[model samples]
Each structure stands twice: as structure tokens, then as C-alpha cells.
Target chain A: MKRSVLPTIAHRLAILCYIAFALFPLFWLLKVSVTPNDLLYSEGVRLWPSRTTWDHYAFVLQHSAFPTFFKNSVIVAASTAVVVTICASLSGYALSRFSFRAKYLIVALMLLTQMFPLVMLVAPIFKILSPLGLTNSLTGLVIVYTAFNVPFATFLMQSFFDGIPKDLEEAAMIDGATKFIAFRQIILPLTLPGIAATLGFVFTAAWSELLFALMLINGNSAATFPVGLLTFVSKFSVDFGQMMAAGVMALIPAALFFLLIQRYLVQGLTAGAVKG
Target chain B: MRKPWLKRLAHASEPWLYSAPSLILIIAVMLVPLVVGISYAFRDIQLLNPFSGGFIGIEHFRDLAKDAAFYTALKNTLWWTGASVILQFFFGLFLALLLDKPFWGRGLVQALVFLPWAVPSFLAGLNWAWLFNPVIGPIPHWLFALGLMDQPGNILSDPRHAMWGPIVANVWWGIPFFAITLLAALQAIPRDLYEAASIDGANWFQRFRSITLPFLAPTIAITVLLRTVWISNFADLIVVMTGGGPADRTQIVASYIFTQAFKRLDFGYASAIALVLLVLLLVYSMLIILLRQTLLNKD
Candidate 1:
């Protein structure tokens, strides 16, 4: 019996169409970033501009507050990811292994956190932080971000821990290792991929956060990349090329990080979403 | 030999010790402020006004009741959330199915496709905005050349269809989420079921209905719930693309709250609107979960 090859061709064609749609905006961003200012309007709507230069990137680096924003974002997102991961690893382990009295309540609390509009917190957080001088501070952003991300990261990590067999730790306990030691020495090593996935997920989330950063941070000194970019867009609305260059720059670290960890992310989700 | 009381105490607290840090942070940062934020609705707390912190019960809500803008925003949120979620889910499911099938270079294709999810929401918003720009963007020109538009106007500026701009951008960014989760769910389905179905003379649609749909139901339900909540609260794209304008056509409840708080600096009013939204969302989530439970019981 012979099967027609039409289905396979159709599938490939459909996939290619998706790929084109997915990458088109990024392609446009890159294209405009390279196109010099003089030719920006003259060669408007061109897929590939006639002439290109790196001047926008050069100026954004030298003339803008973007580097400060970049540095602040790195600090905020990195710290939040690390802190959340550490907290989540422990809590996730508890959720996976323990049937404590508060387990249901804890799960419910996390679910409640997920349900509410975070915009509610803006006013209160600012009011609470202003007296203590946390508003407009990177430390404040990290604390708030860490809290916001913890619930989700904990859930994701719990799923990972669930995927890990209980027998390995049981074996370690039989060899006279305590729970913490066994967790540290045996199960933790096994969960490196999950940890990496958590870190990457939280990092991307913290990096992309805008409303909180916008509300909390005041000036270039503590402003994250999002705040800086929005300010740039509104203040210098005409400089599309430069703004696109900065935008492209912002895309690089996250795109690279997600690209590197996406495999483990999928693997982690395999143990996560499909299960519970 | 009996263990020491201290050791027993430590053992009893093991899970608590593991969970303490997260619990503490969530309460201090989230729960405490959530209560405080809820109270901010009953009291005035303007940022720029030093004397604005005063008890003003029900006034904001009364204003919100009368505020036509808030009602319009409420309607817009429904449209935005409903359209974006449905479109994203279907597209995501399609992509998941496509990726689930074995093909050459599937890995590269996935990375490229999922790349947008990694892009910061801010940039995703701005990039889409740029795409809709009449000058220096091809979308308008393409639309015009295709005769869909007479003059290639940015639909983001067109009040009647402005919401579609952000909805399209949202769909583009969010499809990967559903795709990823569904793809994971797809992979988890036992392969033998399909094999068995084929042997029993089940066609593609029959196999999918019997095996795939049943397996994917739990995931679909959960993702749809999560995405509905998340997307309803998601104000980034709307804020960036329209800033709640071309006459507040695309202003969602979340964005409206943000505008009230950030732009208007009206903490009391923003919190009031937020409280209403929170209540509404809580109701919606409860309904869905209860529905899921009833369906599961039937199953």
C-alpha cells in the first residue's frame, strides 16, 4: 500500500508559515535598527533598507541612560531569579514531599495570588515603600518582584520535584543521610535542569516586568530597561532607529537565555503542566 | 532509644522550615499589602498630595458606579480577554499538533517560533506598534496593496478596530504559551493508544477525539483558566500600543486602573476599581473551577 506524500508537504508548509509569522516583527525591528536615520522615512516600509549603519546602537550606548537601565535590570532580574529559586526549591520540596496541615492553605494562597490583578498593589506598595525609601530603588523592585514570581516558580519547581522519584532520597536516608543532606547531595543534583529552567523562566519574567518598575522606580539611577525604553519612546518619539536599536539590544540577552534553556523548560513543563 | 525533644521539635518543623521563607515573603510583600490596598479603596491615599490620606468610604466606588469610562473599560476587557484567549488557544493547539509530528529541523523551528515569548513584553508591545505604523512599517502598506484598506491607516489609531491591534499583538505573543503547555501534554499521551485506535480502524478525527481530547482536557482547562486570568490582568500591550487611547477604545480594566494610579495619581480610585476587578475575577475563577469539578465528577 502506498500513502500520498501530500499530508507531509502540507504540514511542513504550515510550519514554515508559522515560523515566518513568528519572526517577522523581530526581523522588522532588526531591519529598522540597521537603517540609517536619513533613509528611514525615504525607504519607509522596505523589508531591507537600501543603506544600513550601526549609528543608532552607537549613540544609544554613548548618549542614552540605557546602560544604567540595562545594568539595573540585570541586577534586579538576576537577584529576583536567584532569591525566588532558592525559596522555591525549598518550598517546592516541601509541597512535593510533605502532607503538612497548611499544604492546602498554602496552595490556595498561591492560587489566590495568581488570581488578583497586581495593579492593585501599585498604590499600596508605593505608599508602604515611600516612607521607608524603597520606592524608586532597585532593592524594592527586587523584593516586590521576588514575591510576585515566587508563587509561580514554586509551583513550577514543585512539579519538577514531583517528577523526581521518592526512592532515590529514600535510599540516601537508608545510608544514614538526613533529609537536608540527601536533598542537597542527591536530589538537588538531579534537579539541576529544573533549577536552570526555573532560573531562566523567572529571569525572563523579571526582565520583562514593566508596570511595577514604572511605578516604583523614579529616575535613570534605578530605572530598569523597560522604564528607560518607554521614556525614550515618548520623549524622543521621532528616533525610531535609535529606539529600535535599543530594543534589539534589550532582546539579545533574554532571547539568548531563553534559547539556551528552552529545551530544559519544555522538559520541565513535561513534568509540570501535563501532570497537575 | 528515644530521640531528644529538640530533635523531635526540629523534625516536626521540617516542612515549616522548608516553607517559611516563601511564606514570610508572600505575606509581607503580597498579603499584607493586598489588605492595605483593599483599605486604600475606603481611604484616600494620593501620592503627590501629603494631606490626601483620609477615610472616604464608598465614595470611590460610587464614583466608579457613575463613571462611564470604567464601565466602557469593563466591556473592553471582556472583548480583549475573550478574543485573545480563544485565538491564542486555537493557534497554540494547532502549533502543538504540528510540532508533535516528527519532522526534520523541528528543534530549530521551535526555538524560532518560541523566541517571541522570550522577548520582553515591553518590546513586544512596541514592536507591534511599529509594525502598525503607516510610515516605516510594511503592514499598512501590505494591507493597502491587498485592497483591505483604501489609504493604509494604522488600525491602532482607528477607534472602531483599535482593539484588534493589541489583540493581534497579544495573540502573537501568547500562542507560544498554550503551544508549549499543549505540546507537553501532547507528548505525555501514551503512544499505544493511537496505535490501538489505528488497528481498530479509527480515522484521524476519531483517534483524536477518543485519545487526544481526553488526555488534553485537564491541561486545556487549567491553561485556559490561568491564561484567562493572566491575560485579563495583562495591561502591557494595551498600555504600550495605545496608552488607552485614540479615545480610550482599547482601555482595559487593568490599564484603566494603571492610568488612574500612575497617570492620574488617584490611589483611592485605582484601588477601588482594582477591588471590583479582583472580586469579579475571583467570581469567574470560582465558577470555572466548580464547573471543572462537576465535569470531572460526571466523567
Candidate 2:
């Protein structure tokens, strides 16, 4: 049976609409970031600015506390990503391969942890951190973010580990390698895509997290970019140009981070789309 | 290698070793705090000296029973989750179906559609806030030019429209995940099945209802479940957009918890609220599992 052209046309039209809907806001962000401050309010409804400048970007980078916030955010997010991936990989491999007595209970408990809303635990978390003088510090934020992100990351890594065949590891073990050696030398190398995907996912999540960062850190020096973005909005008026510029600037690291791992990300997305 | 006692010990101990790091981190950071939170919920703990307070049993729970803000937050949270998940899934499924076929620029379109998922949610919320600005935002301006609104700020300021702004933003951000997941599921449907349907003279709608819908149901159910959990926990966007404001009309449970804990420093009361949310989510997940089991049994 031949497919009809009308249905194909309709299908393409629908997709085109979705693409526009999704990308419109991002395009708007890029547009407003370049628009001159004076024209932000004056030119009411223009898609493209009449004139553009890098003034807001320059001012946000040079004059504001954004750079510090960016640096702190990088430290916190990167550390959390590395920490969570390291933890999750070991657990995920165990969950995938082992049949320990408490395996079922452990998986259930991890799922239970994911069920609780983060908001509910905020006070208890703060109380626990404050006594150790961990509150108002990047390390505290990293610890909290890592805890919150690990459960989901573990599940993510577990799925990846499950996808890889057990034959390879069994073969490695038979060749006189210990189980640890089999995992480290044989399985770990094969899981580079999973590691990259997990790292990217966890990094982006911690990078954009605002609640813990806002609650745990109070001062400008330790604030992450999300909290710093709030500084652009005062009680009186919002600095649209500056905020948009900062927003654009904040996209750089995450964008670069993703660009570096796009190969893995693409592979990760498509890896399980079809059966091997 | 064949020593049974040593092998059993190794097998038993290996899991513990493998899972120890995750277990310790979760226990220290997640489970301990959760247990402490439950204890605090029964106490009258202040932020300054959380350990100093004596346990008041269910006093905080009783207080929450009469709290109007708590009820409002709960209601708003339900509204947020229901609206966000339903809209995102449907729109995402629609897009996935549309894009399942071969077409020109399909790869570019898929990339563009998935762009929102790539951008951070905080920035997306910020961008939407600017877009909805009454005087300066192009959206309101466009609405006014089309005679759809009398003024610019009404949408963001009005209680009725406040929640919708964040919902729209969330839906925009979420559609991509559903699209990608559903597209993956759609592609997995064997081409031979579709061809067989076409041979039977089934039209597009008939083919979808007879074959596509049934095959995609499991994936769709899982997607909906995941989306529900995620959207229910979504407070960051609301925090940026309305701060649960315009008279707390948009105060979802997550944002409310943030304010109660951080702003008010009422650790005990906040913990009680958080416990209630945890219970709700558990119940929701259980319900989904039951429904999924029943659906599978029907087949």
C-alpha cells in the first residue's frame, strides 16, 4: 500500500509547529540578550532589535558578581557530577550483576527515597548541615545536590549497565582476571558512553538547581549562578538586559559541556531505541 | 575457584562493597535527614536549636489540618501536576506521531523540538517571565494588538492567569522529553505491522487505534508516571515566575515548603508538610502500579 501525500504534508506541518513552539523562547532569549537596554522597554514588540550591542554581556561579566557565581556553580556542579557518577556506577553495576540477599530491599529503598519531595526534607537537611558549619558553603550544596541527584542517576546508570551483555565480563573473568579487574579493565571501558551520559545529566541538573543553593548559601560570595540571577532583580525593577545577558552567559558552560559530550549524548538517546 | 564457602562469602560481601558508597551517601544525606525530619515533624523544633525541642507527638499534624495555606498549596500542587503532565504528554505524543514518518528536515526539526529539554529549566522560566511581562513582553503586546487583552500586566498579576504562565512554561520545557521517549517507542513498532494494516484497507485513524495505540500504551503509561512525579516536584519554575505570589494563588507544595523552611525557619511545621507530600507521592506511585498491573492482566 502506498502512503498518501496529504497525510505526509500534514505530518510535516505538525512537526514544524512543534519545532517552532519549542525553539521560540530560546530564540527570544538570544534576541533580548542582544537588544540595547534603552530599547528593551521602548521597542515594544519587535522580534529583532533595531540595534544590538554586547554592552549587557560586558557589564554583567565585568561589573556584577556573576563571575564568582559562575565559578562557584562550576565547582559545585562539576564536583557533584563526578561524585554522583562514581557512586552510581559502582551501585548500578552491582544492581545489574549481583543477586545479593537484600537486593530487592535495596532497590525498593532507593525508589522510596526518590518518592519524597525535596521541599519536605529542606528543614531537616538544613539542621543537619548547620551544626557541622557546612551551611552557607559550596561543599554543603554539593553534598545535598549529590544526595538528591544520585538515586535517579543510579537508576540511569543501572539501565545503561543492564544494556551491556554479561558475556564480556564473564570472558574477562575466565581469562584469569579477578572480578574487580574484570569490572575496572573490561566493563568500565565499555561503559564510557554510560559514564559520559550520567556525568552530563547530573552536571546539568546540579548546575540549574536553585532551591538548595538558595536555602544553604546566604552570601554573595558562595552563591551559584541561579541565585546570582536573582540579584539582577531588585525590589524595584528587573534589569531585563542584564538578566538576559547573564542568562546567555550562563548557557555557555552548560552548552560547551553538552557540546563536548554530544557524541555520547546522541548515542545514549538512540542506543536503546532499537533492539540490538 | 570451586570453594563453595569462599564463593558464597564473596558473593554475599561483593554486593555490600559495591553498594556501600551509594548506601553511605544516601544514608547520611537522604535517609538520615528523612528520619530526622519525621522526628522533627512531631516536635516543636525551632531553626536555632532543632534538637532542643521536646516531641509534641501529632501536634504539628493537627495544626496542619486547620492551615488554609497548606490546603491552598496542596490544591495548587495537584493542579500543577495534573495540568503539566497531561498537557506535556499529549502535546509530546502528538509531536512524536507527526515526526515518526520520514520527511524533509526531520533531523533539524527533531533537534529544534528537543531544544527546550536541553536548556536549563531556570533560564526557561526566566525567559517566559520576560515574555509575559505586561508592558515590555511581546506576548502581551501581541495580545493587545489583536484586541485580546486590555492591558499588559493583567496576565501575570491576575490570580487566574498566574498559574497558567508557569504551566505554559513547564509544558514547553517538558514536551521534548515525552516527544523523544514516545518517538523511540513509535520507531520500535515494526514496519510490517503498519504495512499489514494498510493491506487490510485500514485508514490512518484506524491503523493508529488498532495497532499504534495498543503498542505504545506501556511506554506511554511509564512516561506519564515519570512525568507526574517530576511535575509534582517542580517548584523552581514557579519560584522564578510568581514566587507563589499574587496572593499565594500559585503556591505549590514544593515552593511552600521552601518558604516555610527557609523564609519562616519553622523547621517542625515544614517537616510535617514535607511528610504529607511524601505520603501523597507514595500513594500516587502505588496507584500507578496497580493500574499498570491491571492493564497488563487485561491483555
Candidate 3:
């Protein structure tokens, strides 16, 4: 079969176009963040600015409330990731290993959770949390984020668990090890990629959550990155350089985690889809 | 000593014990709140007024029935969801097909193309809003140069064009999700199938129509349906970019719900509107399921 050069060029061109479209926004973000304030308007629409500076980054870090927001977001997202991963691993293992009667019911409930609008829960959750002193706190955000993330993470972990051979855990159990010990010592180490993928996914999701965070947390002391950035944007609408600098900082952890675990994430999704 | 019945009980309870933490969390944080939220639709629950919590008995729904803004938001939701879903799906499918073929620098290309999904929704919104701004952004200037606009003006403030700003941003952000899933499904198709098709003298379109389409049908159906529902509920871009401004032109039901709750501080009305949106979504989902069932039955 003679391969045509035309199709190959077209394919490469299409991929390049897609890549440009995807990264153009982030590139613009980076460009504007580094652009000096005076040049932001004068050099508008230029691919690169004539002059650039780190002054905006310094201002956001030193003068703004963004550091507190960043710290709070990191705490909430990391805690949610660790907590959701632990719970999902146990539940996902059970689903992969057992054929219990309520299994179908459990699956249905999780699916239901995925389908409905979560915005509906804002008022009720606020009502419930306010009295308990959980509202306006990072602890409340972690708890809420963990619950919101568990179902999807559980399904993800289940698919990963399904890919592994049951015999590894069974053999360990047969050697007088408890099932929990087998899962901890033998199986857990093997599923590190899956665990990493789950952590990354949940962390990104928790980091990005806005509406609930905005609704529940009021003060800047407990505000997550999204709430803080939104407030900053509204308050200082003219400070494009500073806001873009903050936006660039917000993208770092999520992007790093995503680039690391994206391969496993797609693989896990494929496994789940085939089973369904 | 442990008896056989006690051992049997432990065996039966093992999965339950494993699932208990997640189940409890879901019930406490999600399920209980959902029930309370549904209840809120009937009661007058004002955020600031302590004495406002009372059974109003369908009063909010009645007010909602007459509200013109609610109706406009409902219409906007359909337009927003439809445009975003269709554009994302086609672009995503094309990208997936392009990536599926072996090419140089494929890994790097894949990483770069999917980077948009990794950006937080709020930031994506702001980034796009800035892009459309005439002062610091380039999009309006480009539009002016292309003669698509009278002058370099921000579309985010234009009632007629405001919706497109968020829609474009959404399509850019969401394409990667569809591509990733479709790409996974594409890879799962056996390579031999394509080889055999080529041997049969089938052209690319014929092969794609007969082989690729059938192989990807289940995935396409599931992903498209899910994306439609999800996009309809997604208001982050709209909320962040326009704040549903310029006379509520970009306001979808989701953003409307946020406005009512956050700005008006009227929790009951917000819950009422949310309940209606929820019911509409359920109906839509049921219709899709039924349609799928019938298609399956015919086969």
C-alpha cells in the first residue's frame, strides 16, 4: 500500500492546530502575567510583549490575600484527596471482590449522585453546616469535597482493582494473613498508579470547586483559591497583570498532578467503560 | 469461642464494613442535604432573616411560574447546553481521530492539547473574559480586523453576543474530556479490523462509517448524553465571565440559581428553581434511557 504524504501532513497540521487552540489561553495568561502594567494596554494582542517584569507576581504574593487562599486551598484539596482515596480504596475493593446482594443498590446510588445537580445542595448544606460550626472553615470544605468526590473515585479505583488478578490477594490470605493485611501489604503497593491517579483527579476537582466554597465560606481567612480570586477580580478589576499572575500560580499544582497521572486516568476510564 | 453463626455474620457484613465510611459520608453530606433542599422549596428560608423559615406551601413555585427572568434563563440553558455539547463533541471526535493515528511527537502533542482541562474552571472563565476585553485582550481586536464587528468592543457586554463568549470558552475547556474518553474507546478497537477493511478496498470514510462508528457507538452515546446533562448544569464560566450581566443575557438556570441564592439571599426561591431544573433533567435522562432501550430492543 502506498502511503500518501498529503494525509500525514494534514494530520500533523490538525494536531498542531488543536495544540495551539488548547494552550493559547494559558499562554496568553502567562504572557499577560509577565507583561509590565504600562505595556498591557499598549501591547494588547501582541504574541509577546516588548517589555516584561516580575513586579505583578511580587505584588500578588506580598500585598494580596492570595497566599492565605493558596495555603487554604492546598490544605483542603490535599486532605480531600487523601481522605477520598482511603475510603474509595476500601469501597472499591469490596465492589471488585464481592457479589453481595446490595451491590446493585450501592451502584445505583452512586450513579444517582453523579447525575443530579450539586448546586441544589448549597442551601441545605449551608443550613446543616452553620449550626455545627463547619461553615466558613477549611475542615468543612474538605469534608464536603471528600463526599462529593468519593463515588467517582470509588468507580475509578474499582476499575483499577478489577484489572489486577484476585489471585495475588487470595494467595496472601491463604498464607494466614487477614484480608485487610493482604490489601494493605500486598495489593495496595501494586495499585500505586491508580492511587496516584485518584489523588490527582480528586485534588484538581477540590481545587476547582467554586459555588459551594463561595456559598459556605464567607471570610478571606477560610476562602479557597477560587473564591479569593473571584473576590480579587471583582475588587481590583483593572489590575489585569496582578490577577493573571494569581491565575498562573493557581494552575501550577493541578497541571503538575494532571501531567503525572493523566495516562493512568484514561486507562482506568477505559476499563470502567468496557465493563459497563 | 466464635460460633459458625457468628462467623457467617462476619462474612456477610464484610463488604458493608468496607463501604461504610463512604456510605456514611454520602448519606450525611449529600443525601441528607438533598432531602433538606427539596424541603426548602416549600418553606420560606431567607438567609439573613432569622424568622423567615416557615412553611409556605408552594408559594415559591407560584412566584416562579410568573417570573419572566426564570423563563428566559430556562431558554438560555437550552441554547447554552446545545451549542456547547455539539461543538465540543465534534471537535473532540476530530481531535481523538487525529491523535489515534501514529505520529511524531504524539505524546507531547497529547499533553499540550489536553492541558486546558487541567486549568481550573474559574481561571478558564477569567482568562477567556480577558481575551474578549478590548483593553488587554486580543479577541475583539481580531474580530474588528476580520470585519466581524463594527469596532473593537467587548462581546461579554453585548446582550446578543454575550452567550457566545462563555460558549466558546466552554467548548475549548470541555473538548479534552470528550477526546480523552473517545480516544480510549478508539484505542480499544482492534487494529485487525481496520487492516481487514483496507484489504476489502474500503475507503477511509467507508471504513470509518462501517467500522469506527459502530465500535464507538456505545461510547459516543454515553459520553454525549452525560456531557449534555453536565454542561446544562455547568455555570462556572457564565458566572465568572459575565456574572449573567448585560440584562441577564448569559444567565442559564444554574447561574440563575446562584444569583437568587447568593444575591437575593432567597434560599426558598432558589431551591424551587433548582427543583424544577432537576425535574427537567430527570425527564430528559429518562427519555434518553427509553430511546436507548428501544434501539437495543430493535437490534
Regions of candidate 2 where Cα sits further than 4 Å from its true position: A1-8, A130-133, A161-196, A267-275, B48-52, B95-111, B144-153, B180-223, B293-299
Residue A199, model 1: lDDT of 85
Q: Is the docking of candidate 3 incorrect, acceptable, medium or high quality?
A: medium
lDDT of 3 by residue, B233-259 (tens): 888899889988889899999999888
- Candidate 2 to native Cα RMSD, angstroms: 3.8
Q: Which has the better DockQ: candidate 1, or candidate 3?
A: 1
- Candidate 1, residues A1-276, lDDT tens digits: the string is 135588888899999999999999999999999999899988988789888899999999999999999999899998999999999999999999988788989987887898888988876787788999999899999999999989988876776676577998999999999999999998776666568767877898899998899888887899999889989888999898989999999988888877777666556544543443
Off by over 4 Å in 1: A1-4, A130-133, A162-196, A263-276, B1-12, B190-203, B295-299
C-alpha lDDT score of every prediction, in listed order: 0.87, 0.81, 0.86
Question: Residue A105 error for model 1, in Å?
Answer: 1.4
DockQ class, candidate 1 = medium
Write candidate 2's Cα lDDT for A53-148 as tens digits.
999899888988889999999999999999999999999999989877799788777877877777767767888999999999999998898888
User: Best DockQ goes to which candidate?
Assistant: 1
Instruction: Judging by lDDT, tell me the better candidate of 1 and 2.
Output: 1
Q: Per-residue error at A155 for model 2, in Å?
A: 2.2
True C-alpha contacts between chains kept, each model in order = 0.78, 0.66, 0.65
How do all models score by TM-score?
0.91, 0.86, 0.87
**Model 1 Cα lDDT, one tens digit per residue, B1-299:** 36788787887799999999999999988998899989989998787999998999899989999999999999999999999999999999999999988677776788888888888888999899989989877888999999999998999999999999999999999988788767766865677789899999999999989899987886688679878999999999999899999898999999998899888888888999989998898899888888877877877
Q: What are the C-alpha RMSDs, in order, of all predicted structures? A: 3.2, 3.8, 4.0
